[model samples]
Target: MTGIVNDAGNAATYAYDASGNISSVARGNAAVSILGFSPGSGAVGSNVTISGCGFSATPSQNTVQINGAAGTVISASSTQLVVQVPAAATNGPISVTSPSGSATSSASFAVTQSSAPLIGGFSPTIGTPGTAVSVSGSNFQTTVNENSLVFNTRTALLSAATATSLTTAVPTFSTSGRLAVTTPFGQTTSSQDFYVPPGAHVVSDVAVTGRMAIGSSQTVSLTTAGKIGLILFDGTAGQRVGLQTTSSSFGSCGTGSLQILGPGGSSLGSTALCNGNYLTAVTLPTTATYTILVAPIGTMTGSVTFTLYDVPADAAATIVPGGSAVTLTTTTPGQSEVLTFSGTSTQRVSLTLSEDSGLGSDCTYISIANPDGTFLVPSTLLCSRNYYSNVLTLPATGTYTIKLRPYGTNKGSGTFTLYNVARRRDGDDCPWWPRDHADHHGSRAGRVSDLQWICGPARKPHHESGQHSLVLLVDFEARRYGPLSLRGLWEQYIRRATDLASDWHIYHPPCALR
Candidate 1:
């Protein structure tokens, strides 16, 4: 505190709070000492040097600031640091900071704004996602986020900056254009164009294509054969949408060559209208703009009517085992309805999908999507209609979706019900169901309905655990099984352990199962 040094050894200065008390993120190591800085005043984007002791040789490790605005360190040594005056820097004292500590200059460092930033060049003109590109500029905000850099329209991540330089990477899904930098004053672009390959940018960010919602219709004219007319719609992944078209030349039925292109310009789904109308459904892969390209089948010119609609699915409706039945309806043969149920990994659930109209499989096509949106069962309209009853042990503990598609050419409704009571497929439906084995007291075990448990609320009870297995026991031999009381069950367990010539130890159970 008594040294002649008025600057930080790392090339920054101690910061003062509102009350003039010093406040800084830097903690000075006793080894750090700042002597002074040369050319104490400089304009924004200009460089100055500080003479110090115990500074870092690594440039980035040494932090320098003009007043409160942080500057980027371009070079450093154990005793000297060269730093640029940051954009947004005003007239104030300069400071230097490192891992050791911070020290302020006794005199103020003047910050002058001579002009807006200028981009001279960026090395290696090929702009691709993740490629490191360094930009030469002037009057740039030295703080990383302060300088807004973009490769074409896509914003690049700013890695480093100084008064006359910027370092960043070409952003993913970026278009080809000159490197552009924007500061508080204004924006500037490089003279040379950075070559980012075309098409990649269109594929990743097709967000705002049209203002059309479900049930809206639009018309576009196809003048000649093979002429593609594109309509844009914004959609997200895991969504299913339907497309239908009508033209006077093609009749009232959906007739036209329509193809869907994803944001990345990849084909999602397409259908060609020959002598008949065409309709199809699609599930999107990512959130972006999807293009519906309409083309005439022949050399006929007409205004085509196109309608976009959502596939009906109630994803919010959840049901419990033996809960109220849910009715799924569809107007088209290929349409499907989605319903969900929450289940655990250890649970075995049963589902029944029936048609009271005696159509059975003719009215229902049932498949499932797991918690992660992967298909558990891929149900199709082309599949044979049969009674859909599945008893399966769930894969994970989350909401499992059931896709109930209406099968056959005739569309109607189907009743769906879910049940938690299911037998294990390994042939041991109820492994814990007590067997009426003759004990020393000749007690007969009574049976209850499927998997009726008297335990937990969230976790599954271990069948082998003594305390859990006790709850599964009924009053088969009421008095012989120790009156079914908690204490009586303990005594019966001890007596039975001796009778069965087995060692049954009492263990504490969580006693909670979903």
Candidate 2:
């Protein structure tokens, strides 16, 4: 046996000689002392080990900081630590801080630069919190502990790893940011980001006027002044909802956008769309049926018909680039299909949309919107049930929304496909980049490109179709980004991972990160 930690969180470390016999076992030590670390030096994302005493048993409580950056502790014990170096780390003294005390190695750890890890694709892009997310990439650390898995800024629990792939779960407080894996070789982040919405499911469709109630839908027109379409839906005390109103004529509200009244005829909140049509949300204060007052905005007039949408802020879906075409179906006249993809400002993208043939002409209408429920591309009504998008430049960095609705009460079905688009530059977000040691935030660091991410320096070419890639067949969302309180969620991840230990494992040193 190499080493074992007792139930008291006290660990005994052992070193064996070539003869298969124990050489040294340090026990009963309390002071934090560094026996020294191996390889002596490595790159920014390099993984390393430090032998010592008086380290905390809870791995998350151990802080291994090299220079000014804090390393991620994969596993630890009272006598040793296994950590992946931080991207911001540099040549400096290795300091280990635990709940028990602090220890500094006498020797300084060296930080060198190397080829960074690169991402090719990821699977099951849409998920709620705690969902397992698998990433396909290159130059990743072979050993799981040697690589750091992070979503936004929260460090995810590393489940497995290889040279080209890694597995982790959506951290509790996960919102937005590309899947970033830091390794001894370097660091690489995905071109696309991940999202975690609250939850979403189709409630109902209101084609013909019906009673205003939960799961019941209604369609109304605001052609004349004071024309209002009202709806009443039961809401839980803390439920939040997003309402989307679609129509053959989808336009902005000039004077007033829309009104949402709570129980007892009280105004809860109001949502307005800037350019394109979207449903903003409001939190319900009590469990009761609430009224949705849809009135004309600005100078909107005529028998202009619009669809109603009550999207409860949490549910969403995703599309795999260069994968199979997704079939969208609408059983009711007022229903619409919504799809999303990650994008950055100035990034160009392409798409193909076609309605199921033989359904007659002029049945489908499509539109692309910004992350804030505004217009990126305005609505386009297809006359032949076929639409091909132009090379379009994205205006911001976030999840872009795509909406498909049947025009003018014409119920229809269709297929939509988005080609793979990755934006990068030399020594930027692309693979094999050996210069920058910091995280590659795509929006600010690179030029827009739709080129394939091969295992070499990125090159430019007219974007092609059907690129060979692992297809993700599940739904995903661009986790909306905002100020998140991480203390509660972050602790859950760390404690959950810490429980996986046998309550007595001691890591050994002299292992190289690569």
Summing lDDT over every window of 10 consecutive residues in candidate 1, give the lowest-scoring window: 476-485
lDDT tens digits by residue: candidate 2, 304-323: 33234443333236775555
Cα lDDT, all candidates? 0.59, 0.57
How close to the true structure is residue 79 of candidate 1, measured as C-alpha lDDT? 78
lDDT string for model 1 (1-514, tens) is: 2133325423334555779776753434446666567676777677888876767889888888787889889889977899888878998887778886776766677775566789988886664477788898688977877789976456888878999999888787664445678986678977666654334332222211232555577776655544445566667778877766543455533445666766444567665533223345677776555667655554545566666767654333566765677876666434656688887887876565655343344534567778998866677442332233334677888988887654433356666667565442343322333333322232333332122223222334443343333322222222112111132244454455435222222232222221
The superposed Cα distance between candidate 2 and the true structure at residue 275, in angstroms, equals 28
User: Which residue segments of model 1 deviate by more than 4 Å?
Assistant: 1-63, 68-76, 82-88, 97-216, 236-240, 246-249, 252-255, 272-281, 310-324, 328-335, 339-364, 367-402, 406-413, 417-514
Model 1: number of backbone collisions = 20
For model 2, what is the alpha-carbon lDDT of residue 44? 60
Prediction RMSDs, each to the true structure: 18.9, 32.0
Off by over 4 Å in 2: 1-261, 264-286, 291-316, 331-334, 344-346, 357-365, 371-374, 381-384, 395-398, 406-412, 420-514
Best by TM-score: 1
